[model samples]
Target: MTPGIPGFRHARLPGADGVQLSTAIGGSGSPVVLLHGFPQTHLMWRHVAARLATEHTVICPDLRGYGASDKPAATSPDVYAKRAMAADVVSLVAALGHDRFALVGHDRGALVAFRAGLDHPETVTHLGVLDVVPTLDMWNVLHGVSAAVGYHLFLMAQPPGLPETMIANSADVFFGSFLDAWACDPAAIPDGVRAAYLRASAAAVPSIVADYRASAGIDVAHDQADFDAGSQFAMPVTVVQQDWGAQLGYDAAQVWRAWAPDLDHRLTRAGHFMAEEAPDEIAEAIRELLAR
Candidate 1:
């Protein structure tokens, strides 16, 4: 079934004190905040949110550097840190007058949700992470073809000058590659969305690189510290991933269980962008969990 999301309205919600995040809110009921991945805005949640809005209010936001948001200078990881991004979620909810809400995230958004779950479990009633693992587990599993499957991870993690220059030169090809590679149905991405992603990525090359660079550097440290402390997401977390590590001798749920004590993990046949590839299932998963 296809979801019909006509359009979205914008708001710059008060977030993390002085920081205001650009957000898109629609419908009404118990709130569900949807955070999207790299090279995508709140639009990624458009289709899913449309279906979700039938029963619940949905909030979709361009996390910091992605879309119609305040692209602040990320001089340090503390500022651009996933933890900081998580704080944006917490404050955004409060600004919208919701004390607690269900949170859903895809790709980079999933990483942000991971941080939010650990840092502010009280604010999130349910956590659904789509298409990515915890930072440290991902680092550990980046072996063999898994590393090759994510070559961009290493390239994007480079310092500002290099990735910025390289991707800036061929923004379409560089950014579009993931669009084709990750999605099972690339045709499902409209030209407007594709063009929008290209434009945003081109303009935010430095910050995008810094985002991944932090994942390689400080993000790693944060995840490692959590590992050393035997800490994981402190919530009823559900993980949905495209079993990428199957060929690499790994079980997705087993690995996720190590990070989420109260976990409900699902392995889907769809490609990496499960929200786009399997919206009905993803939407149902959120609906079911929210009911509980």
Candidate 2:
């Protein structure tokens, strides 16, 4: 059996367009939703969610097309677009009786949360993003040798069939590679959790590829339009990330500032999987963001 956040109860909550999100909800008081990143499920937030649940209602959901969530076919570009995923989040929260909540995400989920803050500013009281810039800015900054770090992004961004076939043929290796490489401490993800992540990701290859493909296409268009409109996040926002800019040749905080004016951008020594690798730091940063 898959392990879950200990005190959290699981549910299949309605998301946008009849999609159902596999959600783990716990605690009480003000609501806060945590979205997990690529190649991983909501389980990644297990540590952080437990910490936050002591004072806040913490909701962790496998985004549409991921983990136990409904994997709707990506018949259209918008299907897996962060905009759509963001909508799923909004609808899911509303279904859980929250009109507004603090929204936080890691990696791909951060993209969705970023979009949510832009599209649903009135509904998100606070925003937290981990380890990623917006899609447009991400594409803008990656170039030459530095771009090598994001090879999977390029591979999965391809036009469907090839990427899906390649990954599915070697699913465990493909999924496990990220879990192994991105964690600063391998022990941070216990053997069981690592197995679960690989299992879930391997089963969702097609939808996962579609998600990345959307980021390369429609997601970028949406982000570009927002940037053109000077749309910025209108909530207390906190971003925790490694000093990726130092390695990739761009100012990470400055890149984020373009989209978030009320931003508290932080540099963490933790790995890409910071929530798992350094839960206390992540939880404390989230608490600080909530306080603001």
Candidate 3:
């Protein structure tokens, strides 16, 4: 049996363009949607979702091309673009009877949430981003030897055939490397959960690579357009991240402040996978964001 959020009921909901999203929904009252990061699924939100569900209806969905969600062929660049994925989030929420809701995401999902805030400001009431800057800024900040930390981003950004072939050849080592390297506390991901993440990621290598490849091409272009137009998020925004800027030679908060003027930028000791490594802190931060 698949491990899931304790109190949530699972469903396959329709996303944008008729794609299906595997989602876990629970709780009641005002709604909040949580989007998972790469190499994991809706299951990443189990701890944080349970806590938020106590007061707010929490919706957790496996983004298209990840987890049990439909992995449509990346026939075109836009298919895996963050713009399209953000549309999926909007559609998924509307399908669940929510016209507007608080939106939070980690890693790749955070990229989608950032775009959603800019593109559909009227729909996302509050925005919470964990452990990543916007895509445009992300690409700009990485340079020289420090960029080695993000080598996978470059590898997967290559044209379709080679990346898919290389990653699929040793999917476990590729996916597990991130899970192991990013977690400050290794025990945060138990054996069962780790196995589940590996299984899901191994099966979705092609789509996952497509998702990253879009970030390199289409995602950057979209972000560039928004930046050129001086677009900013029109809602209260909270960002929780480790102090990566210190090592990477950039001001993390300043980078986010440019995009989110009304921003509450926080630095956490937790590693890249802050949601799982520090659920209580993450949950409390979300509560505070919702209150604003």
- lDDT (CA) per prediction: 0.81, 0.94, 0.94
* Model 1 weakest 10-residue run by lDDT: 1-10
Off by over 4 Å in 2: none
Q: Pick out the ten consecutive residues of candidate 3 with the lowest summed lDDT.
A: 243-252
- The runs of at least 3 residues in candidate 1 whose Cα sits more than 4 Å from the true structure, single-residue gaps closed, are 1-7
RMSD of 3: 0.8
Backbone clashes in model 1, listed as residue pairs: none
Summarize candidate 1's per-residue lDDT along 66-157 as a digit string, tens digits: 77677777777777778878898898888889989889899898888888887787888899988888887887878876579888889978
Total residue pair clashes for candidate 3? 0
Cα lDDT of candidate 1 equals 0.81
